[model samples]
Target: MTRFAVVAMMAVALVGCGGDGGDQSQEAAPEADAAPAPGTVTIVEPADGAELDAGPVIFVMETEGVEIVSAGNMDPGTGHHHLIVDADVDWTLPIPNDPGVHYHMGLAQTEFTVEDLTPGEHRIIAVVADGVHIPLDPPVADTITVVVR
Candidate 1:
């Protein structure tokens, strides 16, 4: 082939060999906007290891991919919040309704206030439980420690 013809053929081959002309930006968009996985829960306030003055402690909780409903709803993918304070949890059994230890938010409330903490360090855990106050399988919870002065 002539010099010009050979160069033209090489140019066409290079262009054709390039990647599939799909938009890379579109391919990455979904991952950036993806929703949280099912049963994801987190504590939004009073960051871990926080130190605060002794008094009423307010807790703010958040959940993703799970619906917060009143206790006894018995609906799939739905439950309420429970605040476990400075106590060991029995994941296989129903959370007890004990004061100053296991606080159940049966009304689907996301915020809670604890007014009975003594001055010291305390372990706080936010747990999501089913309508019957039983924790979900695989256990959706967030634990943090805070010191009260």
Candidate 2:
């Protein structure tokens, strides 16, 4: 009789679950079809901990598993670059996106030249972003601090 009561309760619960029950089970997709990881960006020129001459500033960078579209969405395996100048100057810290505090490279990843930096302590940070010019939730890569003299 206890078993019968238990079965009756289950039937009533199911009936109360009206419509989809909100507990749909799903199968996992194959790992081979999983989304690829975002690219890794590293400044190849003006090696980290280097100083710059008094002139235009250029940034050389490389991004893997991402495209370097100059103006558009960062298609699959593609991403773009953004530059932040004198930004509180720290990578261990999140990149600043303040209107005038940051410089965006948009979709370009090639060399960047900034000719108006005054002679003083300045920061040159390069960040990688997905297409549509949006930085990754946590940012893929950030090269911070390149003092200009």
Q: How large is the C-alpha RMSD of every model relative to the true structure?
A: 13.9, 18.2
Give the worst 10-residue stretch by lDDT in candidate 1: 21-30
> Residue 45 in model 2: shift from native, Å?
1.7
Per-model TM-score versus the true fold? 0.75, 0.59
lDDT of 2 by residue, 1-149 (tens): 99999999998987787432122212223366668454567677777777878887777766654557664674655556777776544434434556446666764645676777677676666776665556655456656566677
Q: Candidate 1, residues 24-58: lDDT per residue as tens digits?
A: 22222335656644575778778999998999999
* Residue 86 in candidate 1, Cα distance off native in Å: 0.8
Q: Which runs in model 2 stand beyond 4 Å of their true positions? A: 1-37, 88-100, 107-109
**Which pairs clash in the backbone of model 1?**
none
TM-score of the candidate numbered 2?
A: 0.59
